[model samples]
Target chain A: MMKIVTRNLITYATLLLAYTLLFRFGLSSLLTAEKWIWVKVIAVIYGAMIFVTAWMTGRRDGKENFLFDAGFRWNLTTGIVWGLVSEGWFLLGLHSNYESIRMIHIPLLIWSGFLVLHFSLFLILKRRTIGGVHKTDIFE
Target chain B: MTTNDTFHEDLLGAWEETYKKGQLTLWIFLSLKEGPKYVTQLQESIALFSKGTIRAEEQSLYRTLRKFYHLKMVDFSSGKGHKGPDRKYYHLTPLGQSLLQSFVERNILLFFEEPLKDLLLS
Candidate 1:
């Protein structure tokens, strides 16, 4: 569990750093006319990073670690971090008078939908297995 | 090999598989009954005490330990490792000990009764 959380935190931190460098360090200015393009690019990168990190964690931990629902927890933590950073970036863009700053909402809304679906799937799976001893439960 | 030999082998394999499934947990508890142990030590103790009938993967053992920890059946504290960082030494809680005692009395002691003993001997 700690390993999963730590890997997630590191992934989020790296993504956050990349966002800050791109937006706060003149990358936004350089791509003034193509602001939407760059924003979409960042959004894609964020999505990809989340997917990759979650996949790697699942692979490393395997189904044995699901006693705590580690995947769901990972998604929840990732959602929180993604939310905060994107909102902060949007605010920075708003104050800096960057065009199409509202474009950030597109990725935010999509990611939020994904999180809802992930959570629903988790609940369904949990309910289905609630009566039986989890395969991972050695005590069973 | 003959068909009869193959069938006999399959029957024994199936029986062993079913028996081994439930035995792992009992063996784990029995191993902890001796004393607190880290993962490797617990694995070795279980294999030794079970006369090599049970073997557990490291990952599965950790998962079981985590579940036991959460259930308050076991607890652990950091202890020195051979050459690396600290290790968690796990011991059974009072709840676990009582449960084990009850299990032995109810299920195990039955095998020692006169009829069962005579049946086994015969």
Candidate 2:
């Protein structure tokens, strides 16, 4: 259990690092004085990163490895779904009337929390499914 | 016969048929004693060791392996086959070894001796 949690934490950390680098170096410099074009570029990079990670993580040879827990399709699909939802929510926040700098951070924070929550949930559910079979007392 | 002996007899009677669902686990464990084996190897070994009296269909064998994998009694790892795509190898765990040992010590196969003796004497 500890091993699974640690591995997943590593995956999350890697994801965060990737996004930070994407925005900090790639998006920030490219988007200067032109927000939409840079956002599109960053979106494309993010999409490509999702595809690459999914492919790497889903490799058949890595099935027994620690990193292959939730599987490629699960990770990529959930991420894409959540990303779209977050984008919509961010847009909603922008269009809303009571907008402030403090409120602006809320949607992004919630989206980040959703990522952690989704990853953790997937791990727990998988562990439970595997662990549940041992309850049959086959050893006894 | 004593109650335990009768129960043993009954169990052996049930295990006599090679296609029975119950004996598949024992057969799988017996086949794995040497080391890790691929699915095809396991299938061939079971049939050969049983003198062609026992055989497992590919689907059933795959399902059994999946269950054993979940139960942690076996480890499934990929290995290159001499020909074709990579084959999944099944290795018995220590837990599996001990459990199979317990089954052997039970002398379940002893029930076959009477029939064997009759055949030899005749």
Candidate 3:
């Protein structure tokens, strides 16, 4: 658990640093001309990173037990972080009167949908009592 | 290498892999049978008891413990760590002890029989 948490903290920190560099250096200007294409690309990349990290963490632990739960938790954490960051960016754009930044909502909406699905699958699997050590549970 | 040597190597490797995988659960139970242990202690005990034959990873041990906890085969209490936060010290429940006892009687003790002992030695 500490290992996973530490790994995730490092990942999130790296991600934040990378995003800051991209935006502060030149990505913000590029976003205007590209009509939020960079934003979409970044969103996709972030989603993939979150998924791969969670999946790897689960596989390392024991997929039969921790896979979906890991994915769910990762998704939940990243989803909130993504939502907050995007909302902040959008609010900043509004204050500065940048029309193109409003499109950030597209990725946020899509991510929220996937997050809901991930959460629902987690709940379903827990209710069904599938996977984990219960796979061979005789007491049940 | 000769074809025969290669084949033998592969076969032995596969057998060892399967054997280790199967024995992990038993070793885990035996480790807990000694006393309640945290994950690191459990890993150390298993390696020591198995004479370095089995070395379980932290994640795998946590996964097994989580399963046991869910199954009510094990219970844990929070205890202070050496320099870190609290740790969960897991101990076998009554059900787990009974199961281990029954398992030893039905399966493990068979190897101690005269014929099986000779076969194993041979």
Candidate whose TM-score is highest: 1
lDDT of 2 by residue, B1-122 (tens): 99999999888877775335467788889899877999889999989887876788876677667667766788878999898999999989998898888878675655457886677678
Pick out the ten consecutive residues of candidate 1 chain A with the lowest summed lDDT.
Answer: A129-138
DockQ of 3: 0.13
* TM-score of chain A considered alone, across all candidate predictions: 0.56, 0.44, 0.54
Tens digit per residue, CA lDDT, model 1, A1-140: 22444554565456655654554444455356556677677657656765776677556554544444536666666656656655776676533455354656776788789888887887766654422224444365
Candidate 3, residue A139: the lDDT equals 26
Clashing pairs in 1: none
Candidates, ranked, DockQ: 1, 3, 2
What would the per-residue lDDT of candidate 2 be over residues A28-121, giving only the tens digit for each residue?
Answer: 3454445667667786877677666646544532332323344533454445554454454446542233224444356556756876777687
Query: TM-score order of candidates, best first?
Result: 1, 3, 2
lDDT of 1 by residue, B4-109 (tens): 9999999999999998886767888999999999999999998999788899988778877877776678899999999999999999999889989999999998
lDDT of 3 at A65: 38
Angstrom error at residue B91, model 1: 3.0
Q: Pairs clashing in candidate 2? A: none
TM-score of each: 0.61, 0.40, 0.58
Candidate 2 local lDDT, residue A70: 48
Measured by DockQ, the strongest candidate is 1
User: Each candidate: how many clashes?
Assistant: 0, 0, 1
Q: On a 0 to 100 scale, what is the lDDT of residue A85 in model 1? A: 58
DockQ by candidate, in order: 0.27, 0.09, 0.13
Model 1 Cα displacement at B66 (Å)? 4.2
